[model samples]
Target: MVSLVCTLRSHQDDVNCCAFSGALLATCSADKSICVYSARDFSELPFSPLSGHGYGVHYCCFSACGQYLASCSTDATTVVWSMDTGEIEAVLEHPGRSPVRVCAFSPDSSFLVSGGSDGTIALWDFTSRTLLRTGAVTDTSIVACSFTPCAQLFITGSTYGDLRLWDLNMNHLHAEKNAHDLGVSCCQFAPQIMKGTDGCVQFRLASCGQDSLVKIWIVSLLSAAGIKMQLAHTLTGQSAPILSCAYSADGQMLVSGSVDKTVTVYQANEGVLLYTLNQHDRYVTACAFSPTAPLIATGSMDKTVNIWMLEDGSGAQGKSLPDEAASVLSSGGRKSSGHSRLMVSEWSEEDVLAWLREEGLEAVIDMFKSNNIDGEELLSLTKETLSSELHIESLGLRCKVMKKIEELKMAPVSNGTPDEYLCPITREIMKDPVIAADGYSYEREAIESWINTKSRTSPMTNLPLQTTLLTPNRTLKMAILRWTTCQ
Candidate 1:
């Protein structure tokens, strides 16, 4: 059973949005203020009521690190506020001076996208705090946006009843017009990346609209086959327009808030309604699932935010943490923070930050975040680069940073290697690769870490693994050695 843990009435006006990071929760409202609360006891932080917006705040989102909060307003700007000090870090103006309706940080936190009332979308380089590009759809306000887990693409849903996909370069990859009958109020991609039996990368996206329906779409990306998004299922649990939808950290469950003052939770993949919560006294405007817990926060026009805890044994605790923290978890995690799902050459700026924190090099986290150091940039980091580009004053820290980068480069498939030689868990060329019970070969350290933390299950199939024993993939290792020598 879902139990209400607490109700926050800090906002004198309607609560427009609520977001949670690993340790904190933030809610914004028409009161033109943002409230910060510690997830532990639901107490407002001393520095809360962050008040930089000139007009009613419409939305607020936390960065992946939980260090910063971004909020947009009717005043035509999106402000990034430091959670540590409750101070405004940057004020990004929308391109057309139009009221900004929503803003979202990319999965890696390297980019920020803000959609405005005038149908304009501005993409910003978060590190540099500069506008990279802008796009728009005529006659429609962009109301919702979400980045895919891979960080390579994003989807924006608008009042035109369309969902448009775009790449980092702001190129329109695809568009699904009439995705919703009336208009889309919210859209979010599931955190997990699934691989089908056919080898195509599959991503699930949940979208809700004014039509009182929630949709699950399967987006498939193939190297040569192009991109295809197919409607997988539709949920009609809500009786009125759903305003917000969110996927649980595991991507197994979905929760949405509606105009009918109800929150419906569903089994995402199977499209089964799991629970219907009616604690809100007015139209529910926002909903979010905690990234590190089985808790959910739903906000309503009643000017309150209700926190609900998923009771133990509800299967909510079985899932691993979100993708960013999965590898760093003690069990069912990577061997070290140096390890990640993407190849070292493909790591994003936030990936670098996570590794730094895991490696106890938090001193340089800000330095790396400021420079937007991604996987390729990570591979290229050197003592000289750290000192020169990153301005690290301490020689020891520079040396440590360089050493970690080198370790990252040597950890997995560094670059210029065939994908076949890579471990599915760590995406690194396996030096001591072993075949698991699922007939998949993974690096010894990587697979062991995963098995220790997660249940004895196949990473690819999510099926029960017959055994923990992993046989050495000597032939594949030999092939990798040969390929390395040739390189």
Candidate 2:
């Protein structure tokens, strides 16, 4: 229920901010940089950290699909990164005297929102980083904002106890409310459409303020019509100012970190405390839970990133704790860089054939040679013979067959033997034969048998000899049988 799973110490100064998606966690520091770690192994993943900010980093958050991350700095810039390749997608800068404090991604990942010290909010297109809208605050600086689950609207909170809802499609202010009596430190969009399991389709917003109060609000159509949403509950356990708050994916758990140097996990529907984590020596600045994992990662002013997990979750009960020193992937094996097993199953027959073609004729030759045959000579002979027959342009296939016979006659054989042999007419082996002898100098029977195996059983005339023989006395005779109609 309460344990430090892993600790990352790459940052040199106070690591005051962190963010987690389904599989990754990123932390920001007063060292003016950020480091992202993998949720699977707790080791560093490949990411190019952006560090051109003049001041220290403050906060970071990932998009829904885990493809994009937004990090804000006191240097007045918010940098967007491509999470998959760890490349900077865009750099957002404000024209006024505002230092960017925190940033968040739209649920659909099409836009980004940032809060600045000048009490203004800026919206940037996800791809172009071009400003879409800018809204000025009334009294205090806006510190945080979150988009609804559908990304149609967003809510921004200021230090002067103000919360404003902006309609993204209309590019105008939708609603405003006094969420707290003091500075609102952080705010988040609840995963549910309503606070309770009712038919109401609304969004709940969780905010922590300088009053040490954690408040929840319902942003439904009923509430937008000037009817205030009922405050579901308020958690009052933390003695210091609450700095961060987030809801679990299932909306069953709520986690909050504070200047009180402690982070508390609470039941979402009920305000009862489920667990309390107290590992930080200094104030805990931010905390986040991986949506698909049982992990919880936090950054503290003590200059370290701590990861924890629930006791009953898989890999937390009986599994070994992750060693921070281990590699990101399993060691000493071929890592599959692309397609998985399920991907291969979905490939079509055409895809398989195309893959084979990419292997080329060289692979085919290798396969043929594996059977102890000269595949190169066989292919070359076939090509040349086909070309010659086609060049002659014969109508019947007889000429091509004759050409094949000549090729077989001229082909060099092994053991220095001549290609054409004088076969024995009566036996399977060669021997010395007399002039009138029915025997031959070679195995005519075997050759005739081999040639007959390839015959089509067509009517015979003065057909080409399937085999030929020569006697010991040098008499030569074609093995062809002359079939004639005797009348």
Candidate 3:
């Protein structure tokens, strides 16, 4: 289980991204600033709210040793900050004044790689504060880039939905492919490797895009064809475009954020959804799992950052029992000396219907009713009969059932009227609310439109706007959710 532990409210505008360096949490925003906070208590650091970028900071990352911090911005520059002193050590810029969108530090922390809107990728030796090399991976802007564990190879994802593999020297393209239907927004390598047959190590690459799908690829360092790559699996569940993805330090879990306003955790090897965190009311733009703890940090367009704590023993916790054993439990049957018999024959149709309703299995009940099957029939039906007669394939049905079960298990059941939750402007339950400069809350879209086109003033106060930034009112939102749950 994953539960929201704290919400950080410092960014005046949308929180664009977040990262973790040991016990420190860093977040960047459209306010052209970055803030550092304590991951343990969500307290703002003394030297936080670092402001130097001329434009919105798009991404931020920490070096392997957590000694240095790097942030890329639309100001066409990347700033390297000394974490200890909170001082700028170096500022690297693109030659064409193109907006820098993504950056990564090499595993050894000796070099940094950055990609920008001009389709250029630059490598800089941080120790010397000098650009080592520059090249273009595509004519379109590059949106995502990351170095492999070995630091000899890195991958870049482009706005054109192309994925390219590059050598460390940035002189060779090992392979390239059209990986997604829309812009490839994020990519990361698995933190662990699988040993191949010939003693070579095989790694997995995960990429998400505007296509609302996550694709996994197998990359082998030593193949007969030389650095072979193949599609491993495709995960589909998010309703909107995915913005970011990251693998846990142990590589047993994968976490993804989407514009669908949810963060999903998946079992790395099996590609199964373990949890769906839905506390954010707007697009979840960035997510990162802590390298040393069972914690996750997420930033959203809602203008808030949330830290989630995964329960102990819950990471990548797969099915509890084998397939045969699960079947036996569901049937309420006990194994004899050498045989098994149905033990639930005494359950009546009404009793079974009540149980199903209690368990939120209305869909299954409807299916049974459509087939004119009763409680006794369902209890006695064999697995083969249930599948064949209901025309239900195991894979698809199993996924749906598992997802529903997990959701029900984690969600707090609620029943309440909508009047108290209605937005002041929309007069309906607010899906995403923002606090304007007038000290009043309104739906984000309604307030943005009021400020942009109508007038440069507060709709509620009719006063000239002090600032255009809208801060998220997460406190009220949480209160409304809790009120509904207790009703």
Candidate 4:
């Protein structure tokens, strides 16, 4: 069960998209404007109502670091905005003059990709304010685009009811398949790899269409024939077209918004319906989950956005059978636990490895290096030896070590490589990089703040700037994006 925490009413027209960036939330609408609000209180920001689009804003997304926001419109332009100032940093226009329907930022925040109604896909270096490439994706409009977790691949959904996978280079089509009977409206990659039957590992993608069905795909890049995608599951319950779908950060659950004025939640792995939320008065347009919180934000054609908190089972008001009776019911009255018992009893090293990989803990060996322990040494040490050296009881030390391992499992990997594409002030990779008059490029927001609040002088050098205007560093931005793709 879930409960609505807040209902925001600011957009006069339909709210098309909603995205969360830590404590901040951004929403765009058919009112031809974008609004930013504090997620903590749902208060509109002082510098919000960013209005520059010539037509209705169709979609908006925050950069991975939340420093920049990108929105596409029916006017055939995609504008990148600095979240710090709520000002446009760059404007990207497709060469074909097609209305951009969807846009997405790569995981590294180095590239912005937009798909348009003309079936053209445009890749832009937002930091440089330059278009990197434009290619045709389909004969019909593209409605959604999403990058894989690794940022190496992207998938696009089209009005032709097809889903296509493309390489990050924007030069090759990896795979193409007819995905739905009606136009595909939304698509998203699962935040984590999924384990399927037969000990197979797969990258999962969820897509919803006007056909009123949501389909989950299993993509295998290691196939003998190269990248391949197959339908894994079809979730059929929505009576109207689904407008959006999203996976929770940990990939345990999936959520979808539909034209039926309802939102649905499902168990991601099993496709089990968990709950249905019918709080909106009109069609639900977009749905997203906070990356670090058990919160969901849904936008609707009713011109409102609602925030909901995912509840635990303790809050569920349902009766359940006793353990023995429940077990019998689940097992069809069998005395033994049957195949489920065999699966648990026969867990193997392969299964353990699979679980670790799925949990993003495959780099545990690297994580242990901070403690001056090598993989070899750790493997050689016995429980007694470890306990004696640490001066603790064997069981206590084992428990503590297990807890420490769990903590380290979520620690970020130290690649030790400095990102040259980062802003000098914020120390984050630049999402809207711009070059000032002093021949140094900084993040758009960082430089704008320096010029507007601190001083008109260049931050890099103490020289006074003759003009506060900045130029887009298109070449370096494109170079950085290409470099990131290779990485």
Cα RMSD of all models vs. native, in order, equals: 25.2, 33.1, 19.3, 21.6
- Whole-model lDDT per candidate: 0.82, 0.62, 0.73, 0.73
Candidate 2 vs candidate 4: the lDDT winner is: 4
Provide the lDDT at 130 for model 1.
Answer: 95
Please say which candidate is ahead in TM-score: 2 or 4.
Answer: 4
Considering summed lDDT, which 10 consecutive residues are worst modelled in model 4? 328-337
Instruction: Give lDDT: candidate 4, residue 222.
Output: 60
Q: What is the TM-score of each candidate against the true structure?
A: 0.65, 0.61, 0.65, 0.63
- Identify the runs in model 4 with alpha carbons over 4 angstroms from their true place: 194-201, 314-487
Clashing pairs in 1: 331-453, 332-453, 332-454, 347-375, 413-428, 413-429
Tens digits of per-residue lDDT for model 2 on 1-487? 4556666655646676788887788888766777877777765663434455655687888887888888887656898888778877777886463567778888788988888766778888876779988877754677878888878788888877777778775354554556677778888988766543544567877888888888877766553353345677888868898888888787777788888888888777677777666766778888887788766777787666777766564322122223332222222112212221212333343433332232222233333333332322332334345345323233333333333333333322211222233232221113332332223233434334423432311111112333343234343223211111110
- Arranged by lDDT with the best first, the candidates are 1, 3, 4, 2
- Identify the runs in model 2 with alpha carbons over 4 angstroms from their true place: 169-178, 195-200, 223-227, 313-487
TM-score of 4: 0.63
Clashing pairs in 2: 193-202, 423-442, 424-442
Question: Whose lDDT is higher: candidate 1's or candidate 2's?
Answer: 1
